[model samples]
Target: MRGRDEDVISGRIVEVEAYRGLEDGASHARFGRTQRNAVMFGPPGIAYVYLVYGMHHCLNVVTEVEGHPAALLVRAIEPIAGAEWMRAARIAWLASHAGNRSAVAIARGRDRLIAAPVTQLASGPGLICAAFGIDARDNGTDLCDPNSMLRLEPAPSEEPPPEIACGPRVSIGYAAEPWLSMPWRCWMKGSPALSRPGPKAAGTGGTDSARIEGTEPQ
Candidate 1:
């Protein structure tokens, strides 16, 4: 991710969930295409961002072929570079919730961000958006393009990939039967940055039932 000043921030992906059109009951395209979910039925390697609970935005990577509404929800990331930028972005975002932030409030937010563990920096989809300054304007961004401000890059070849584990997707109680239990959520095994623990611990219920244009998690 890049700030307005072009200061770049990086994070290592740690968790994700998959959604597909029509067949996937939990997906927004489960019905058909619309202006809101057009990005999901993509040429691939682009973004599919949406809001949840009238607030928090979640990011996804468009997948499959053009006309195929499939995408991967990026649930968590491990902050790797530009920690200060990410922290400041997150603080500024949080401060905006109540209106313009005072000098004292900004200072207190900085203290909180500093006190927080690095592992918690981008440990959830919403947090990742807050830290990276992403919103609906970035919904169709070409994440694979090097020129894109919010680009995604593969880990260095010398670095081994983390062990991955799959389980039921989170906060989709709206889905029915088999889809409800389908283990599609994948995450780096044993990563402390995961948005949630194992399936046995996650369950099917979600805190918020509100959805955004039928694309949100819950």
Candidate 2:
């Protein structure tokens, strides 16, 4: 989970797409260093966030050596903790900025017996951020430090993480050809939390699910 006292929100990362600057046409670094993509060129274990369509804030995790500008775009997640807080955060954001009543109603599905599953709370990049109170303010957020409000932590389990899967990233059709066909996306295979459909990955389904693992924040 990522949060502070009284407001903890967590999710099972299900989908992600990789971006490589310079060599890759879809990367923000295709044009070289600038104000917006500077963070991606920095050290690893930090968030490289960007605003898309003037509203959505997409989150990426900086990885590889510094200056290489490689990141994994977090595409989707299944909410697992503090789900109510996630809904409230999203609802509040819409109420103040969009006044999207219906969206808020769907978010605030308080009908218990008919209440929405927490898994649906964060199914997409924008929705995931909103559900977790993550924004541009967290663009340079550290994912390596446990103390940071936004941090990557180990899965609360002793067993090994589920198998990883790869597929072509969503959107960026403009990249064309090789870039388009490159299966750089990663995820916990067969997760319903996936943002969209893709080729079936190996060793998915059953009781297996996504859990924080490897090098956790801090």
Candidate 3:
């Protein structure tokens, strides 16, 4: 059984629609579902790990039922317990990608960077995985199995409010307009973990409140 704290960190999942094989507007499987997409055809609650941009690892949960070929894209995650560990992992990753002196300085300064306290650590998919220490090693892991490192537990009962909203998934330009317009993303309305003040807040006069948005809550 997952401890309450562990469940708070791992149980909830964010779903996103990926393009299907060939005819898909935005899918790596567009050419045809192959060995790479075998997980998509597998039973629900299974991991569907895939490489994105030919580099970063992205995780997904096969949804619906067996042979349904649907999954939820784990775009981001809020670090619940192992924040220090997450920061260290992100720093190491950033440092690796950093070019020279300037990049290294930016990476070092990232320690002070404040991200959403909610599960969407960084808005993008790769950053979210890095922040939460998720990788290919977790591919095909059964979330339903208590012994599995990757398991989904119930989200905390004490979240902000009861209201849930949806918006288009981020950074999927290839998905086209209507696909981009689909409000599939969901997040808490005023949760600090899910929302943050804009960068301009620290600058010259502004009094905007925190606005939360993302895939539709399940």
Best-matching candidate per TM-score: 1
Model 3 ranges with Cα > 4 A deviation? 1-24, 99-123, 156-162, 176-178, 193-218
Q: Which candidate is the best by lDDT?
A: 1
- Order of the predicted models by lDDT, top scorer first: 1, 2, 3
**Tens-digit lDDT string for candidate 2 (99-169):** 44576474454343135566667778887887787888999988999899888877779857877766567
Where does the lowest 10-residue lDDT sum fall in candidate 3? 206-215
Clash counts per candidate, in order, are 0, 3, 15
For model 3 the local lDDT of residue 204 reads 58
Sort by TM-score, top down from the best: 1, 2, 3
Model 2 lDDT, residue 16, Cα:
85
Clashing pairs in model 2, backbone N/Cα/C closer than 3 A:
144-218, 152-217, 155-212
Task: Write out the backbone clash pairs for model 1.
Answer: none
Model 1 stretches with alpha carbons more than 4 Å out: 1-6, 99-111, 198-218
In candidate 2, position 160 carries an lDDT of: 74
Per-candidate local distance difference test: 0.81, 0.76, 0.56
Q: Write the per-residue lDDT of candidate 3 for residues 1-218, one digit (tens) a residue.
A: 12344433332333333433334445554545578877776788887777777557787777756544666776545455655555566767766666556955884557544443434454456765666566777778887877676677666778644444445555778777555655555554333444332233335533322223433333
RMSD of 2: 5.9
